[model samples]
Target: MLRYLFLTVTTLAIVGCSNEQPQALGTLEWDRINARAIASEAIVEIYAAEGDQLEKGQQILKLDTLLQQAKVAQLEANVSVAQWQLEKLRAGYRTERVTAAEAALNAATSDRVTKDRTYQRQLELRAKNLNSQNDVDSADNRYQSSVANEKKASEELHALRAGYRTEEIEQAQAQLTAADAALRYGKLLLSRYIVTAERAGRLDSLPFKLGDKPPTSAIISTLLAGDTPWARVYLPEPWLSQVAIGDEVSIKIDGRETTLNGRIRYIASQASFTPYYAMAEDNRARLSYIAEIDLLDSDAQTLPVGIPLQMVKP
Candidate 1:
């Protein structure tokens, strides 16, 4: 009879120790969130409102892009001019230009020949005492000047017929490349004027209205990603040692018919008092560590933020 009583007592102790009931007390939260603007500009248009569901890369707001657009336009014109210059260099001199250069060279040569003959005649006349030494000297100077001019015109004509030099064409190509890069950079800057969602999520708020200028570091809106919903639960000092990261737990949400499964993603290293204003000092002093639980099911993401959740030992 005493053995039977001992067995009953042992069974009761085992059952009581094995079962740990969980209390419902946590709020749904977002682990992935988007906030703040990449740059500062006056708000021009608001494409999204509070509580609007948005897809990744969806346009959220537009900043005043008048100046940016104008800058892009100017860069585009510069690129066009650079391209035309490069093409002109590649095409070399036109047929008409070559012909004109050749004609100038011929004229210069004829002038030089005429001046040489006149100088020779002047020298012969001076030798015979028919002209003064000053006349011969003046004619010689004119002949020398014509010779220099003729050489210059000949070189110009040769250059025109030979086409542009390799170095000249390369320099023009470099200028065109620089212009293209500048245009691309200008367009990239202009794209920043339109704010888009970085990920799929629901927009929470827009702090500024249209025409309001916000600082670059200021948050324009807050977004909560529509993935696995995380729950922030407080574990009392007594339960702190029992919880750890990666431990699975059963979650029951208030007003929900089904329970969800989750894993412990984080546990605060330090304990703090629960922020309960209405509670007495003694109750608030009860230290609890904040533990974050990530819901495992994709369907559970539909749970709204701020909804209460309960954690149970599985």
Candidate 2:
């Protein structure tokens, strides 16, 4: 009878131990996001403070934009000038200029005719021994000069009538397009001077205060992203095969009586151990796989991060 009682007690204790669920220890955490400065400009205004709940696209801070705005204005002026130049090219030469060219051509032709007549008269006189060789040479030179002037004027008139060349017009258009693109880029850079929140979350920190100049690409703000916190737990090798992503689990906070509901969201492919080369059976048991469990309850959103918790497998 004494032996049977001892056996029965041993059986009950073993059964109770087997019924206890396996638990993994972890801490509550939130996804962190950083907002960086696009330029090394002084912070002029702060729209949101640390710990403030922020909405997506909400203004977080403003950097000094005076210089950027001036640059944009200069680009705008260049765009305008380019536009005018393109318009001028497309319109071709003005009517008044064409008329002037025509008039110049006619005047040059009249002068050339007059000089030719004088040269012919001088040559005839020289042939009759009435004029010296020097006189004939001077008249010949004047006639040649007038002929060159007439040819130049005629070409100028023809160019005016033909208007701008196709290549010239295309070059002007390309310049305008380039200017417009530059202006658009300047405006985009100007917009970056005002920093805004990229996601809806609680503002965790503001590294720069008002009037503080932050270097380019420096983190200006930090946010704890997501509505609810997640549990960062390590799954022992023994339970690695039992749990998977999307599996439901129970979460017990260290100081809370009520348990929270969660679902496994991620599990590391590699196991984490102090010494990677340890292949002994005892060392293999020490390997733990990193995993993340997302809280499903709305109240979990208000929970503070870094609080100890236990994830109990269901």
Top TM-score: which candidate number? Answer: 2
* Model 2 weakest 10-residue run by lDDT: 274-283
Q: Which pairs clash inside model 2?
A: none
Cα deviation at 79, candidate 1, in Å, is 1.7
Off by over 4 Å in 2: 1-24, 119-145, 271-288
Please provide, for model 2 over 224-307, each residue's C-alpha lDDT reduced to its tens digit, 9 standing for 90 to 100.
Answer: 988789998877677887888999999998778999999999999998862332233334446677889999999998888788
Give each model a TM-score.
0.68, 0.75
lDDT agreement with native, every candidate: 0.83, 0.88
lDDT of 1 by residue, 1-314 (tens): 99999999999976775563424267888854545655677998999998999999999998888877898999999999999988988898999999999899999999999999999999999999999999999999999999999999999998988889999989989998999999999898788778788888888778899999999878887888856788888776667667779998888887878888899988899877665631243365556778898889887877788887767743
- Give the CA lDDT, 0 to 100, for residue 60 in model 2: 93
Span of 10 residues, lowest total lDDT, candidate 1? 277-286
Could you tell me which residue pairs clash in candidate 1? Answer: none
lDDT assessment of candidate 1? 0.83
